[model samples]
Structure formats: C-alpha cells, structure tokens
Target chain A: AQSVSQHNHHVILSEAASLELGCNYSYGGTVNLFWYVQYPGQHLQLLLKYFSGDPLVKGIKGFEAEFIKSKFSFNLRKPSVQWSDTAEYFCAVNEGAAGNKLTFGGGTRVLVKP
Target chain B: SAVISQKPSRDICQRGTSLTIQCQVDSQVTMMFWYRQQPGQSLTLIATANQGSEATYESGFVIDKFPISRPNLTFSTLTVSNMSPEDSSIYLCSVPGQGRGYTFGSGTRLTVV
Candidate 1:
C-alpha cells in the first residue's frame, strides 16, 4: 500500500507571509498527486493536482504545487497567504492503476492571521 | 466539474443505531467513492461503488459495517450500521470529474451519542 507523509501538522502565519507545506509519498509507479483544502464548516475542495507534464502545477486561490518524482514529493506553496486561506490542507496520491483510489496524508491545519 | 448533493448534512444518532447517507451527482459517473474523516484527521477512503456491481471496500472496512448501494450511475448511499462513538465523523462522497480530478460532496456529519 502507498503512504503519504506531510511534514507539518499545524502552521501559523501572519497575512502576506509566504507558506509552504511539504508532502511526500511512497510509490514507485506512475502516480497522481493532489492538494485539497477544507475551511471550517466546509467540504474538501481541490487546490491543485499533478497528473503529468510540467512539474509545477498552479491551482485556484494563488496556490501551486511542484511534483518532483525523484524526491517523491509534491509540496504546496503560496507566495503570500491571506486570512481567507486558513484551512486544513491534505496531500493525496493515487496510484496510476488504482482508478482514483486516493491514499491521503495526515492533514496540516494552516491558520493565517490578519 | 460535477456537482454533488449529499443529504442529512448532519445527524446526531443514538448508539447502536444506523444512519444512511445519500449522495446524488449532477452528472453520470462510472464510480462513486465513500470516505471518512475523523475529527482532526485526513480523509480515508472507505469503499468504491460501481454502478450495477458490488461495492469494493478498503481494508479495515467491511460490507456489514459500511454497506454501500449504487443503484444507478448518478447516485449512491452509504449506511453506517451499529454505530458507536468511534463512528462519529464526517462522511463524504466523491466522483471523478472532468480533467480527471475528483469532486467531493458537502459531507455528512455523523455524531453517535
């Protein structure tokens, strides 16, 4: 079974601060990566995904993630975060032949203070 | 992307009871997924429901405890049976959307008292 590991469990930052969340997965074959965010009292929403092609993938709300195959990592980053960006972020990996079955990492709760 | 409407956004049920959560998708899909998100935890895939076929459950989940129904291409239901406090969590349904990404439902918050 594939496993995902997130380096941080909680993050606190002031508005306009740069943010980065580290994610790593253990899977040798082709894999699809995703970042999903959930605000308080809301459902999980896709932040970005890496299926193939360019390593850097841009997503909604000014978020982006870079897929590094050699490192087995797809880390989420933002140049500057806003208070509205406060949410719980999760990293998930889908094995190529797994047909959308996602293995998720323990989530990281990010709190951006205004 | 496809839109998903899930029923009983939240429910407080007594222990040993059962609760069935329904998910309806706006578009037809081949497979529907059920997931559980415990408090302060990440989402865990429970099973995959295929239209007209038996649902495939992940390890640690069973058909008896989390029975799933996929009666058609656009709808499915997950029933949590013999609920206990440990079963209290947010249950979500997902389907593969355009561009290969997955769309998630609003989620059903189940609390066993």
Candidate 2:
C-alpha cells in the first residue's frame, strides 16, 4: 500500500508572494509523481508530473515542482502567485507497475488574496 | 490527451434511490477509473472498469454499492445504488493519456436528500 502526506491543510498569502506546498509519499518502489489543481466549481487539472530524468519539473501556469528522491518529497513551488492561483492542490503518486492507479494526498487549499 | 464528457453534471435525489453517471470518451481506452471526492477531501478510487469484463473494486468499495458498467472501450457508467447522505459527493471518471498522464471528466455532483 502507498500513501501521500501534504504538510499543509490550508495556505493563505497575498498576491505576488512566493508559495511552496510540501508533499511527501511513502512507497518503496519506482513511482511517478504529479501535482493537480482544482479551482472553485471546476474539475481537477494536471499541473505537472515527474516520471523519469531531471528531478525538476515545470508545469502550466508558472508552477513547478522538484522531486527529491532521498527525502521522498515532491514539493510544489511558485516564485510569485496571483489571485487567480487560489485553488485546492493535490499531490498524487502512481506506482510504476500499479496499472496507473493514483494515490492522492489530503490536499492543500490555497487562498491568494488580491 | 483524450477528452471525457460526463453528465448529468449534478442531481438531487431522495434517500434509497439510485443515480447512474455516464462518461463518454473521445478515444478508446483499456481502463476507465471511477473516483469519489467527499466534501473537502481528496479523490479515492472506487473501481477500474474494463470492457468485456467485470469491474475491479477497491478495498473499501463493493460491487453492490458502486456498480460499474464498461460495455465498450469508449464509454462507462457508475451507479450509486441505495443512496444515502454518505453517498453525496463528486464522482469523476478518468482515462490514461499519452506520456503516462490521466485526463478527468468534469464530474457529477450527487446530493442525497
């Protein structure tokens, strides 16, 4: 069995502020990491993913994440956030051989103040 | 990526009733996944539907409660039988895309009264 842990349940920040959301997973096998964002009244959308190669992955909307294998972490970060970035973010892990099934973290609700 | 169209979008039903949500994909896929998102919670996989075969349910889910129909490679349906307030949530369908990504539907919001 695999599980994901998101360090923050909720985050609040002003516009132009830097943002970082911590995500960690527990799986002792080859894994694929992903970040998803769900805006208000919208469905979940893929932000970015890390399957192989360089640990640093960049996503749509100026978002990015770094996969640190030693720490078992895939934390999402943005140098500057806008009010439009307010949404609930989820971190998910797919076991390399688990038939594409994804295990998601609790989620972090980000509120960007204008 | 494949596009998924899911409906009704939303519905309100009385207790003990049932609601069947449908998903139609633009392309054929080997497996379609159904997920449940409870209030303020993350998504949980309910089952995996494959054409010409029975669905494989997750640990906490049962066939009787969450019946899935995968008649073909491009379409699937999930039925929440004998619904209760606990069954009220967002139901989504997903299919694996190119480059190992997954594309999701808009979701169905079911409310049991």
Candidate 3:
C-alpha cells in the first residue's frame, strides 16, 4: 500500500523565516503528489500539486514544492513565511492511474509568530 | 477547479443518533470520495462513491457503519449510523479536479456527546 510521511510534526518559527516541510512517499510506480493547507477552523485547500513535467511546482500564496522522484520526496518550501501562514499542512499521494484516491501523511502544524 | 458545497458545516449530535452529510459539486465529476479526519490526524479515505452502484469502502471502514449514496455525478451523501464519541471528527467530500488534483468541500465537523 502507498503511504506518505511528513517528518515535521510541529514547527514553530518567527515571521520571515524560511519554511521547508519534508514529505516522502512509499510507492514504486508513478504517482501524483499534492500539498494541502488547512487554516484554523477552515477546510483543506490545495497549496500545490505535481503530476508530470518540471519538478518544481509553484502554487498560490507564494508556496512552492519540488518533486524529486529519485528521492521519492516532494518537499514544500517558502522563501519567507508570514504570520498568516500559520496552518496545518498535509502531503498527499495518489497512484497515477488510480483516479483520485489519495493517501495522506500525518500533517505538520506550523505556527508562525509575528 | 470545481467548487463543492457541503451542508451542516458543523453539527453537535447526541450519542447513538445518526447524521447524514450532503455534498453537492458545481460540475459533474467521475470520482467522488469521502474522507474522515480525526483530531490531530491525517485525512483517511472512507469510501469511493460510485454512481448507481454500491460504494467501495477502504480498510477499517465498513458499509454498515458508513452508508453512502451517490445518485449522480454531482451529488452524494454519507450517513454515520449509531454515532459515538469516537465518531466525532471532520467528514469531508472531494472530487477530482481538471488537473488531476482534488477539490474538497468545506468539511462537516461532527461532535457527538
């Protein structure tokens, strides 16, 4: 079975700090990767996705993730995070050919202090 | 991306009661999924709602506990039967987006007491 792992369980940082959340997946075949964010008292929203082509994918809100197939990792990064970026982030994976059944990782809670 | 409308954004229910959550999509989609997110946990896929057929449940989730109805391409419902405090969580509905990504509904947070 496919699984995703987020190494960081909780991260606390001051504003303007560089952000990098590590995500690794266990899958042998082609896969689609995604990063999702959930604000306090809100629903999950897509931060970025990687299907094919370039490894670096930029998403809304100044978020970006790089898909490194050889490493089996798709890590999310932000040059500088703001206090508004405080949210829970989740990394998900789906078999490329399998419609959209996602396997998610334990989320990482980010607290950005202003 | 498709927009999803989920009803009863938050509900407080008594134990042993049942609650049905509804999800309506703005556009037709081939795949509709139901997921459960327990407190401090990742989202777990509950089942895949198939149009005109029985839903396919994932491991640890059974049809008896989570009955699903997918009548068409844009609508589905999931009913939690005989809920307990353990069932208190956020239930979300999702659909495949145009880019092979997913669009999720504003989850329904259930609290059973």
Candidate 4:
C-alpha cells in the first residue's frame, strides 16, 4: 500500500513571506504525485500534478513543487504568499497507472496573516 | 472539467437512521469515486462505483455499510446505512477532469448523533 506523509500539520506565514510544505510518499513503483488546496467553504481544487518528465512541476496561484526521486519527496513552494492563500493543503499519490485511487496525506492547514 | 452537483449539502441525522447522498455529473465520466473526510483528517476513499456493476469497496469499507449505486456513466449515490456517531464525516464524490486531474464535489456533511 502507498502512504503519504506531510511533516507539517499547520503552517503560519505573514504576507510576502516565502512558504514551503514538505510532502513525502512511500511507493516502490511508478507513481503520480499531486497537490490540492481547499479554501474555507470551497471544494478541494488541484494545485498541480507530476506524472512524468521534469520533476519540477508548476501549479496555479504562484505555487510549485519539485519531485526529487532520490528523496521520495514532492514539496510545495511559493516565493511569496498572500493572505488569500490561507487554505488547507493536501498531498496525494496514485500508486500505479492502473487506477485513480489516491492515497492522501494528513493535510497541512496554512494560515496566511496580513 | 466535469461539473458535479451534490444534494443535501449538510444534514443532521439521529443514530440508526440512514442518509443517501446523490452526485450528478454534467457530462459522462468513466470513473466515479466516493470518499470520506473525518474531522481534521485527509480524504479516505470509500469505494469505486462502476457503471452496470457492483461497487468495489476499500479494505475497511463494506457494501452493506456504504451501499453505492452507479447506474450510469455520470451519476452515483452513496448511502450511509444504520448511521452511528463514527459515521459523522463529510462524504464527497470525485471524477477525472481535464488532464486526468481530479474534480471533487462540495461534500455532504453528515452528522450522526
């Protein structure tokens, strides 16, 4: 079975501050990585995904993640964050290309202060 | 992206009762899934509803507890039967959107008391 681990349970940042959220997954074979964000009272939306090719994947809203195969990590990063970025973020992994059953991590609650 | 409409956004039900949540997609999709999100936890997949066949449940889930129906390509329903306080969680349905990304519905908040 595939499992995801998010090191940070909660994160707080001031406006204009840089942000990074660590995500690691345990799966032996080919895997697809994804990042999702859910704002207050909104549905979960996909931030970005990494299926193949370049490990550095860019997502919406000035967010990006680098998939380091050796590290088994796909950490989300943003040079500058805004108050509007306050939301709950999730890291998910699909074990193989056969199915879409995603295993998600314990989410990270991001609170951006003005 | 396929748009999904879910009914009874939130409901309060007494123990031993049942709640059936419906999900209707705007367009046809090949795969539709149901998930549960407990308070302060991540999304846990309940089952995979296959059209014209029985649903495939995960390890901890069973058909009698979470009976699902996928009558067609774009619609599915999940029923939380004989609800208990432990069943108090947000239920959501999802499908593959553009670029094989996931598109989730606004979850149904089920409160079993």
Candidate 5:
C-alpha cells in the first residue's frame, strides 16, 4: 500500500518569511505528484503538479514544488509568504501510467502572521 | 479542469436518519470518485462511482453503509445509511482529468447528532 507523510503538523511564519512544507511517499514505481491548498472555509484547490520531464514545477499563487525522486520527496516552497497564504496544504501521489487513484498526506496547517 | 458541484453543502441529521449527497459535473467524465475527510485526518477514498454499474468500494467501506449511484457520466449520488455521529465529516466528489490529477467539489459537510 502507498502512503504519504507530511513531516510537519503545523507551521507558523511571519509575513515575508520563506515557506517549505516537506512531503514524502512510500512507493517504488513511477508516480505523479501534486500539491493542493485549502483556504479557510473553502474547497481544496490544486496548486501545482508534476507529471514528467521536470523536477521543479511552478504552480498558481506564487507557489512552487520540487520533485526530488532520489529523496522520495516533493516539497512545496515559496520565497516569501503573505497573511493570505495561511491555509492547509496537502501533498498527494498517484502511481504510474494508468493510475488514477490518489494517496494524500496527513496535511500541514500553515499560518502566516502579519 | 472540470467543475464539480455538490448539493447540501452542510447538513445536520439524526443518528438513525440517512442523507443523500449529490455530485454534479460540468462536463462528462470517465471517472468519478467519492472521498471522506474526517476532522484533522487525511482524506480517505470511499468508492469509485461507476457509470451504469455498481460502485467499487474501498476497504473498510461497503455498499450497505454507503450506497452510491451513477446515473450518467456527469452526475452521481452517495447516501449515508443509518448515520451516526462518527460519520460526521466532509464528503467530497472528484473527477479525474488529464495528467492524472483530480478536480474536487466544494465538499458536503455533514454533522450527525
């Protein structure tokens, strides 16, 4: 069975601070990676995704994530954070070619203080 | 990305009652799935809503508890039978699109008393 792990439970940062959320999955086969964001009282929205050909993938809202295959990690990052960036972030993974099922991490709650 | 919508965004029901949640897709899709998100827990896949056939449930879930119906490619429904307080959570419907990514609905938040 494949599972995803989010190293942090909660993250608090001041505005303009750098952000990094670590994500790792237990899977040996080729996989697709994604990051989704959920603002307060809103639906989860896709931030970015990695299918192939790129280790570093850029997403909406100034967010980006790097797929480090050797490390089995896909970490979400941003150079500076804003108060509006406060939300819960989830990292998900799906197995190779014909895979349609997604395994999601426990999720990290991000709080950006002004 | 396909737009998905779920009805009864939030609901409160009695323990013995049942609630049917509806999921509508803007366009026809080949795959639709239902998921549950318990408080502070990772989202769990409930079942794959199969078109014109019975749903395929995941481990720890069954049709007796969660009956699903996919009448067409663009719409589906999930019913929580004999609800309990433990069943209180957000129910989300998702559609698989290009790149193996999924588009999720706003989610239906259910609270059983």
Candidate 6:
C-alpha cells in the first residue's frame, strides 16, 4: 500500500508573498506525482504533474513544482501568490505505472490575505 | 478538453435510502472512475467504471454497496444503496485525461441524515 503526506495542514500568506507547500509520498516502486487545487465552491483542478522527464514542471498561474526523488518529495512553489489563490491544495500519487488509482494526501488549506 | 458533467450537485437523503449520481462526458473515454471525498479529506477512489463490464472496486469497497453503471464511453452512474450517516460525502466521477491526467466532475454532495 502507498500513502501521501502533506506537512502543512493550513497555510496563511499575504498577497504577493512567495508560497511553497510540501508533499511527500511513500512508495517503493515508480510513482507519478500530481498537485490538484480546489478553489472555494469549485471542483478539483490539476495544478501540475510529474510523470517523467524534467524534475521541474511548470503549471498554470505561474506555479511550478520540483520532483526530488532523493527526498521523496514534490513540493509546489510559486514566486508570488494572489488573494485568489486562497484554496485547498492536495498532493496525489499513483502507486504504479499501469493502474489509474490515485492515493491523495490529507490536503493543505491555504488562505491568501489581501 | 474532456468535459464531464455530474448531476444533483447536492442532496439530503434519509438513511437507508439510495441516491444515484449521474456523469456524462463530452467525448468518448476508455475509463471512468468513481471517487468519494469525506468532509475536509482527500479523495478516495471507490471504483473503476468500465464500459460494458462490471466495476472494479478498490480495497474496502464492495460492488453491492456502491453499484456502478457504465453503459457507454461517455456515461456512467454510481448508486449509494442503503445509505447511512457514514455515507455522507461527496461523490465524484473522473475521466482519464489525454496526458494521463484526470478531469473530474464537480462532485455530488450526498448527505445522509
């Protein structure tokens, strides 16, 4: 069985402040990492994913994440955040290559204050 | 983009009753998945809905409890039979993305009282 852990349960930041949310997964085999964001009253949307290739992947809204295999982490970062970024973010992992099952982290609720 | 639409955005149901949530996709997809999200929790996969075949349920989930239907590529349904207070959660359907990502429905908020 595989599991994901998010270090932060809640994060508070001011507008224009840099942001970083930690995500780590426990799986011995090859894994696929993903970050999904759910805004208030909205469905979950993909922020970015790391399937293969570049360790650093860029996503929408100037957000990016780096996959550090040694650390077993794929932390999401943004140079600057806006008040609109207030949402709940989740880290997910696919246990293996073939199956589509995704094990998700507990989630981090970020509040960006203006 | 693969668009997915789900019905009955939110509902309040009595315990021991059943609620069927519907999902419709704009394009044909090989796989449709059903997921359950408890309040303020991560998404947990309930089962895989494959067209023309029985659903593949994950560990701790059974067919009779969470019966699913996938009549075609673009349509699927999940029925929560004999619901209980513990069954109160959000039910969502997802389709495989072109890049192997997933496009999820808005989710059905099920509250069993």
- TM-score value, chain A, candidate 3: 0.98
User: lDDT tens digits, residues A1-114, model 5?
Assistant: 999999999999999999999999999889999999989889899999998987999999999999999999999999999999999999999888643778889999999999
- B1-113 in candidate 2: lDDT tens per residue? 89999999999999999999999999999999999999999999999999999999999999999999998999999999999999999999999888899999999999999
* Root-mean-square deviation (CA) per prediction: 1.1, 1.0, 1.0, 1.2, 1.2, 1.5
Model 1 CA deviation exceeding 4 Å by range: A97-99
TM-score of candidate 1 relative to the true fold: 0.97
Better of 3 and 4 by DockQ: 3
Model 3 / residue B111 / CA error / Å: 0.4
Best by DockQ: 3
Runs with alpha carbons beyond 4 Å of true place in candidate 4 = none
Per-chain TM-score of chain B, candidate 4?
0.98
What fnat does each of the candidate structures reach?
A: 0.66, 0.60, 0.74, 0.57, 0.51, 0.60
Tens digits of per-residue lDDT for model 6 on B1-113? 69999998999999999999999999998889899999988899999988888899999999899999999999999999999999999999988787768789999999999
Q: Give the CAPRI rating of model 6.
A: medium
DockQ of 6: 0.64
Report lDDT (Cα) of residue A70, candidate 6: 94
Mark the 10 consecutive residues where model 5 chain B has the least summed lDDT: B94-103
Tens-digit per-residue lDDT, B1-113, candidate 4:
89999987999999999999999999998789899999888899999888888999999999999999898998999999999999999999998777657789999999999
Q: What lDDT tens digits, residue by residue, belong to model 6 across residues A1-114?
A: 788999999999999999999999999778889999999888999999989899999999989999999999999999999999999999999866544778899999999999
> Which run of 10 residues does model 2 chain B get worst, by summed lDDT?
B94-103
Using alpha carbons, what is the TM-score of model 2?
0.98
Supply the TM-score for candidate 3. Answer: 0.97
Check candidate 6 and list the clashing pairs: none
Q: Score the docking of each candidate (DockQ).
A: 0.67, 0.67, 0.75, 0.65, 0.65, 0.64
lDDT of 3 by residue, A1-114 (tens): 898999999999999999999999999899999999999988898999999999999999999999998999999999999999999999999997747699999999999999
Better of 2 and 5 by TM-score: 2
TM-score of 6: 0.94
